[model samples]
Target: MDLPRHHTIRESSHRILDPFTDAQLATLGRALHLTPGTTLLDLACGKGELLCTWARDHGTVGTGVDLSTVFVAAARERAASLGVEVTFVQGDASGYVAESAVDIASCVGATWIGGGVVGTLDLLGRSLRPGGIALVGEPFWRTDPPEAALAIGDFVTLPALVEQTRDAGWDLVEMVLADEASWDRYVAAQWLNVRRFLDENPDDELAPALRHELSTAPLEYVTHQRPYLGWGVFALVRRP
Candidate 1:
């Protein structure tokens, strides 16, 4: 029902949980051409940054669902702080559905909640109006990994991703890929957050694990993840 404490601690300072910078997110929003009063249903909506920002910037109304109680609370607070009205529910996003079809449905960087990309798209489709947009944020392999055993299993190449979306009955309309800088910022920020948590809670039971993560994550990210992984938010629509 709630995220593990360690996960929350590691991402405590993140506004946007994905590897998307504010500018990139804004660009995606613009690409969507979201009009005022557009409805958005965001699943696994960590901290509600996308909903809150879209609400404030585009006048879109939305509901966000997440399993992390901490993140849900932060999302609510973020909505309030932005003076935007957004409903953030603390629950499993996989089982949640909108009361009615929505203009935009998104499940960013948490597709595993619905099993994988195909299942996640099916899940998101349940809340999307016919012809409405679906925004799926996922990672792809930038290049073949040097060590096949160490490669991330969930990620495929960009072409494979597009083909998968097509096979699932959606057309890829637009996309915003995260550059190296964005990836570094996103991953590096988590290290800092984890380190800060460890510093402030040296006696905590999870300190050892957090300390290990803080120590090793940067090198692992830069060496293995940075060059190999590409993350992006894709705009898709159901094909007739």
Candidate 2:
């Protein structure tokens, strides 16, 4: 599916699709040393949860860019709801030129920008001020990817993922791993969203497609991802 529609679906299921939980956000905040006056940029920010939170909690100024107009509207509404001043732009994150350099930049769970992790960091680096950090949330294969599995989607092993980041001039500053419970929570949430969509749009053609996707997702995830992928978040800093 194209990115816009994919992101629309993700925005519809964000909390569930997200690998990070509330507890994990706390951990990440501590890891980033989030503070007042920090300028952050969230590339592919879905609904601007983190961006708005950072602005409110840390007094951070931020910008969030996403391709989905639906998500952009949601993000803006969230920012207003929180009474936090943050810019949420509707645009392709890969092509989004920063209005100003940021002290921290992030691409949580959307690494397609730089062709993968390494490239994403490089792109983030270019948008960062000196001594800035790049926080990337990525899924790693717990074991080596099977030939068939690798072909199924964008995936990489843990060691390989780490090696590439290190080679790309970033030092891994912090990390958080997802447990089985987290995985189940994240994936299962999708079914609820799809079900809601079906109830509201009974005659919509995409409903069946979404239903089929949700029905098969758990099995595919258990078979292909559970045994192979190790999901985690990493905060990387450009070496000063």
lDDT of 2 by residue, 109-199 (tens): 8888768888888888888988888988888878776775675567767888888888888898888888777777777776677778878
Residue range 58-120, candidate 1, lDDT tens digits: 999999999999999999999999999999998989888899999999999999978988888
Query: In model 2, which regions exceed 4 Å deviation?
Result: 1-7, 10-17, 145-148
For all candidates, the clash counts are 0, 0
lDDT of each: 0.90, 0.79
Please give the lDDT score for candidate 2: 0.79
Residue 85, model 1, lDDT: 94
Q: Report the Cα lDDT for residue 69, model 2.
A: 76
Q: lDDT winner among the candidates?
A: 1
